[model samples]
Target: MMDQPATSRTIDTQCVVAGSGPGGLMLGLLLARAGVDVTVVEKHADFLRDFRGDTVHPSTLDIIDQLGLLEELLKVPHTQAPRLHAEIGGRDVTIADFSRLPTKCRFIAFMPQWDFLDFLAREARKLPNFHIVMSAEVTDLIEDGGRIAGLVARTPDGSVEIRAPLVVGADGRNSVVRAKAGLEVESFGAPSDVLWMKLSHQPDDPPYTMGHGGPRQGFVMVDRGDYWQCGYVVRKGSFAEVKEKGIEAFREAVAAVSPLPADRVGEIRSWDEVHLLSIRIDRLKSWWRPGLLCIGDAAHAMSPIGGFGVNLAIQDAVAAANILSVPLREDRLADRYLAAVEKRRAFPTKATQKLQLMMQSSSKKRQESATKRSGPPSFVRGIARWPFLAHLTGRLVGLGIRSEKVNMAALKAR
Candidate 1:
């Protein structure tokens, strides 16, 4: 009988990316497009989870445009927010105007994160070398001679060990890959957490996507076609207290901060409908080890103030892929190369975190003075009145401090 080719049970690739979030998925897609065999391991069965980062900033859309996927991706359901408004005290102030941004897509695209991930996955699969292993969770590092050779992941069949020269940890803030690699993070505790709830959309609600804050209560409402996705900002570690107070009290508090129709606030009738995200402003002091690299929230956790998390993650992926793709493909990547990724991204990460901390402090002060009744503060009016300040604020919220560009040459198929 002719010798039969043995069925290979082990999955091998040039790179094993942990977490299928924006950063991980982008890096995987970019690397695969460059003809590198890459595999992404996702802990979840699918990207259908709720309350993920849904704001796709202009910078990220530019990346999609660069890759020629923007038009197709936009076909998915989404809304464009060209301006950000905040009803402070009782005055309506424009906080950010994306119309002033230079990018082709000047507005923030609000789409469910799952749709974004699905778009990337679908695009990546068009390339023959890309692979995604869903429902596979990374459990430990596969060490060989004191280097992070690869990782051990628990999958459906059993424990599966993947060995590769490079293991990218895009897992997230609480990252198993980062933990296994022993990366230390410096946390600047957040003053507030967010309670995510939705209210039914009404025709009478203000047309502008806006934030509303009155004394201690702050919430943001974004138009999602038929509904209002509301974020109720509360003091850090207050979920238990909020819950103990019962759903009606929480509903009234949120209702007070919403710019939407107050009657619709009753839509949030149960605590079950609300999701709590304990905000933390943190970053890894160092973003890499000998054979492992962390990006996105795995390297730096952003506060939800500006909806910058998804954009930052996408930028990190671009920078990392630009720096590491060639070295990884040629089988000559080194720790210094990983160091360069950190060096390139550290400034923006620090700058964003610093701003988030400032916002948190300011919010805490506002909450303490909740009893005061007044009009919008001078700064709020100044931001709306001064064109320069408004433009600067818009750029900061839209493009970030230093936006990253994905090198087309690096991503070109070989």
Candidate 2:
């Protein structure tokens, strides 16, 4: 029980998880399956938001099959593409081929992120111990002797306090929980920011469902079936420059690189339709303090280079659940356990960030010397030439450096 004075303002549970994104929801769901009393608080009222991380990579699909949620989750609306393609020098080049990935599903499922989250949320709610509080935004950390014990949040009803043995910060990039806890983040600055928008896709449009990337000139288009989810990567802090060029010029630029008709770009209409994401490639140097631990986007903010951001977040959640659930249930959450979770995940996080930094460095080079810049670099084309190497690329993209397996062995099913 909480040592705080008896007050109705406080709600106690075994674990209090913040944020309802992929990582947050996944951690909560797995923890609940491990028979832990967990409460997930989300500031958003619903999961029906336009999310850019729509590619559910093969590794994540493998995890779903493990939980026996694959059949049911696949019942939701989604599209699948076996191979990821990119347009290089006007040639359709295969980047990461998922067709040969040895898994239950050898394709990336392109579903609305909301549908993915809702499916997980519905499954989570089936457990009596799992409770979700929506429209609840965490305002500050609840500390005792410099140790984080819980959090203070503003709910629709009133400001309430949640006290738990462990308080997990799974909030996004600008995590209030991470900030309030005084954790430090190290930055590996991104070379570009993403301008996300949607335009109606026509039957005559390019049939490449994996999307296209043209050096630094074109926008990446994913086939979301009805409306194409398009994102233009502008040199960091270049949105205003793009905006000042006039919408017509911007439309022409998009059409020059993408397969979309010039008139289709006009559907974007004005600058207001363009959503600017100040891309950040950073991660917390330290992920915890005492009774608090962080996972997912809270600990590391990834660049959307390979659509591995969401997959990485989900992997963090899986690793966290594997390590923390048992300790949390038995009331043995120590600083070392938190450190172990960090240690287990640190390698994958850094390795992925290292790859992203290399991409950013190359992008900066392309920006400085336009003459030297062309279609995708030589290595990207080299993989497509060799059939065997393309499959290896699929293995890396589909599975990642270290694929985490779920271990819920210590608790009884509720």
Candidate 3:
């Protein structure tokens, strides 16, 4: 809703963020903190519904701590996912141990995505510069002279046109802003589909475990407190077939792979509790236009293997905010904002895509070999066994792997 009288002022110096998910809302919060007039438009009216992608990784925990949100986040009902145990070659190996991480808060927090988003939204509302327009859908981007300047939205009452100096596309994989900007996304690898369902917490539930079946390549992350998020490997477009087989068959498949008891699986009944996500890694050659920039799932969509979507989205928000803080205060800041955002996000996007490919490899032999390993792979285990190797491996996989260096470099550059 418009805060001021329509006759008194025009909608100038606006920031149109298309999605009000974690990425968009976080961006809104950061921009609003920087004294930017931000308007976040979300299609959803409330944040009570269930959604996929719940695991908050350790890297994001560090950022949350830096933002002074770590304590508040811990106050929420969440399970500390300390260990990432995977069944490789029928042998369990702990790949990521949060307790060993350097950060004070080391564990990956297992909380519903909606809860996290709701927390962020509550914090963002405390800032006067932030305005959230829920139940409003962005129909299209308003372009002026080959540059993105604003967006046209269909609100509850009527059409609202918000003209801004910069438009950030934080919408999910299917981004309206990306389409309007005519950005070309370079498709990297094959699509990996996941059929995910959650089960109710039972008294007899097994100990917290993370399971990965070799042949099926399915994974299950059991929360420490209650509920289990189960994901199955399926064909790229076979969600309907899996659903057609009925919930009983699905439960059997999950029980056979996961460490949890079969009876616990019976708690799931409705299709509403289950969701199918088609995952892919897409990188745009350019993440900027004349007056707009894309971040999070809008610019790069990585495979969901490492549970990195939400973390990467938040990281992207940090980068974009840091880059735009200075430029956004100027009269013509769109160009510099876009360039800086792209520079900050480029390496991270590429590194994440590479990791996605490593996880998505469908080679049965590789899966079997990985599953057969007694502990973390020889290369990884060798390091864990020795203090030096452990530190080295930790540095390589935990921090040095992928885009951490690049992200840190970007932050330093800013």
Candidate 4:
């Protein structure tokens, strides 16, 4: 039955989770493991998209360990980072260090997001009650008597109505579920946008990862084994000016801050190869309405700083499963149960976003200042000066402000 495509006119499940992302799939997996019937719907046929967040922080690693899947997850090929490095005004400095985190794996595992998604799908499929419908785009919410009763998704064959008492919107930043649910978003503007492209790594390149930021420009280099996943930052809404400057100038800008050989920038032959991510920092005024709930990026969108987006989303999933699994299993799920998730996760979400906003604003100010040869930013230099500061930042980035642990009850449910 799992092999069959979603062609039925109506499907029933205890919980309907939209989007097959880290948050959605994790929530679906946890709920299913808790003996609840769960369905996760993905708009895409496969998780092969590039430039997605791939950083698996220690918080998530600890959660996997609690689930007893840490050994299995480590088998997948990935690069581990115990400490974060950055170049501030041409001077190298160590920033966050995850080595001291109180987790089974103290380092971040950088794996391609597609592989991670595939792994979750495989594990979830092992459960008899879990189902994932791919290429099924959610078109609208099925609202009944002022409460969300289910969702309507358009599949390859046709449309199908998934009925459930609770609908979990784990979709991404531009969430159709939240939009259809009439949730209001409070948008905090971003100062810059990012252009992501890949460049081949030379044998002689530095052995470790480093982030580069200069006057009015910033760059990032992630070691993707054979190549480097590079990101070039430009002032918000400046990509048009970048294009007008010609691809050669764009290549030069990338070469300016990065330690990689200038010749490697030529690999980015055209603008089409580059992906632009317009950074957004915002959260919904309310994460749930009646029978519907929004978690992950659907509830709040975080900045790319510290690679916290995916980790925070997974935190939401862990907390959701912990708070709602029991009530859901008892057929007593209520709006208060959904609201509890938001209440529990709201602090970490707000605190993380605040930190990102502060850093982004500070960076913008430094870039706009007349000081040309500034060393590391004051905070970063402080981190470099005080080793404990690095540990503190590491804990914040790796473990988050409030990390959720997997509930034993949920794990033992059968």
Candidate 5:
């Protein structure tokens, strides 16, 4: 036969999660572990992307412990950040001390986002009821009787239709599920965008540094064992201007604020190496409808401040599993059960976004003010002065406003 027509398939599950990000994968695992039939659809073939959020906070580590995957996760190559550091106002200061957190691992583990995703996928694959369909982009939501019933996904091979009682739009900020479902989003605009690139890490480099920015520039470089995952912040809608200035000029700007020597900055030899993350902070006006719910960035897009985005997304998955598992398994997934997930997560989401906005505002004001003083804001300076404040910052950054625990009831339901 010279050619043959591609085939189509239909899958039926109790819940279908779109997107294989932290939120989607974690939710699939939790639901499957609870004896709920679940499927996670991902548009990508592999989780090999660079410069995604890599900080796994203590809160997430505790959740992993609850799932009995902590030892395995810790076995992966990572850097432990018990104390977060930053260069503020030309002074290196310890910002958050995770050493005091009340968790099994009182530190933020700096692991590549790919490794983390792969770990979750691997663990989820071990579950009999957990199904992951990679390279399947969810194109549209399937509706019946005025409620979302399933979704249509397009794969390279053919078309795949997944039928489920609940559709989770964990597909991230530009979620097709949420868009198709006609959910309203309230945007809290971001002040800047980030240019992400990698620089070779030298043996003599600082062990663990977080941010390096001044009045004219903003940069964050996290130690990634052999390399530095760098993010250069530019004013919103300014990447074009940066490109017009040429790559050399951009490299100079990076060098100006980089803790690395000038030679290391040259690694960014071309514009292709720089990835621009157009930051957006927004949340859905409502996180759910009758038979569908949205979690993680699908519900609230978070700024990269504090590297809280990944942790918060995973938290949403945990909360979703806790609140909706039984309801979904028992065929009682009413609107209230979906709404309960939102109610459970809304406070921490709002509080985290508010804190990020406040920090962004403070940075913007400091950059615009005509004051001679050129250090971090007064509160940050106070944090440096008081050791206990670092602990407080650690709790806020590591544990979040309200960290979630895996509901044992959901786990035991299997």
Candidate 6:
């Protein structure tokens, strides 16, 4: 156990951030850079796995560049998934073209989330004020007079009581800290379950591409060189059923919808290679309670649509860091920090959720229509023939759908 520094001890202000994922690590790094003694705790001991949410959006890349970690991140093996090719309203459109964006870091980079988390951890370690404890799980939060005071965590050796003025919950969707704080979250829509798997790629495999079959239907993103991230849509909680169907049936399903070559899909076998990601979004009415605040998935979990979960989590981390970088003793600093984070992220969260619902509903409709009709829908044919309507419909469903100006307005209102 490390003793509190003199500076931190003088004010009795210690910040404990739970979960050493990207959001928690970045939050710890930012706070430490601002001269705040921060400790980041994680349940996992190492970043070694294939997880979902690998695509880093351009907006998040901008923030990474702002933090001076862009150069280091680029050095890591990553695939630039710049074009979002989506089959919306039965017409294919590409949004988020790297050429159109003004920033030098305009492309969406596709790398494992673990790699991104590792990069953040490495950068955070450079700051002496930042400390990280792996293999330590936060089991309970310590409350003082209805405000968060610290946390009770179980390390490998034993349980330890760590004190802090502000406790941050960056611990993901199933956060123990949020539960301990007694925060109520409002969930939306039925759960969207995904059967995610990675296939080995030969050197001669075709170049990486993103292919979206329809709404509700899962898509594929080529990561690094030969490995392709593929997802299949299933009911809210039907992973076991899908798994029972076997890998061969799953490959046939992928071949039916995706643009990927049949040979690649054939390589996948066993449930071990396939990951099941059950997606749900919840928004807490209030992300702050006295001395505690929640960020990242702990604060709001959004749909995987647009791969905005990680980006949004990092965005919340950045916003929280900006607001809390000031002295905690400052009057209502915690209150202002919560308000700022909620304000900055609410619109983005809403926008992404709306998109997710739209895609889910549309995909269901398309599947139903496919079952009823022998051929493509008339509306799809109309759009395909009329290029003008195709572009217009694309803009409506795919391009510039979220207004940054409106989102910024919501942030300013807070």
Listed per model in order, the count of residue pairs whose N, CA or C atoms clash below 3 Å is 0, 0, 7, 0, 0, 0
Model 1 regions more than 4 Å off: 1-9, 371-382, 385-387
- Model 4 alpha-carbon miss at residue 115, Å: 0.6
Model 1, position 4, has a per-residue lDDT of: 11
Flag the better candidate by TM-score, 2 or 4: 4
- For candidate 6, the 10 contiguous residues with the lowest summed lDDT are 403-412
Q: What's the TM-score of each model vs. the native?
A: 0.94, 0.95, 0.85, 0.97, 0.96, 0.83
- Candidate 1 C-alpha lDDT tens digits along 334-397: 9999999999999999998887777677667666676774333345557767746866777988
**Tens-digit lDDT track of model 5 for 239-277:** 999999999999999988877787788899899999999
**Candidate 3 local lDDT, residue 189:** 57
As for model 6, its CA RMSD to the true structure in angstroms is: 5.4
Q: lDDT for each of the candidates?
A: 0.83, 0.82, 0.69, 0.88, 0.87, 0.68
The reply for model 3, stretches above 4 Å from the true place, is 1-10, 87-92, 244-246, 270-272, 362-414
Error of 1 at 153 (Å): 1.1
Displacement of the residue 400 alpha carbon in candidate 6, Å: 9.9
Write one digit per residue (lDDT tens) for candidate 3, span 1-414. 333223322356557788977789888877777767788888667766654567676666676676678899888888875666666555566655556677666666778888888888888888887887777777888888887889877766666777898888988888888987899989875545877777666687545556666354466665636666677766577788878998788777777776666687777776777787787778788988898888888888866655667777877887787777556645448586678778867886777677666555533234456555422224434433443543333333333233331123332332
Superposed by TM-score, candidate 5 places the C-alpha of residue 123 at a distance from the truth, in angstroms, of 1.0
Q: How well is each residue in 45-100 modelled by candidate 2, as lDDT tens digits?
A: 88877746877889999989989889999999898878877776667777778887
- Which candidate number would show the highest TM-score if scored against the true structure? 4
Residue pairs in steric clash, candidate 4? none
Using TM-score as the yardstick, the better of models 4 and 5 is 4
lDDT of residue 110 for candidate 4: 87
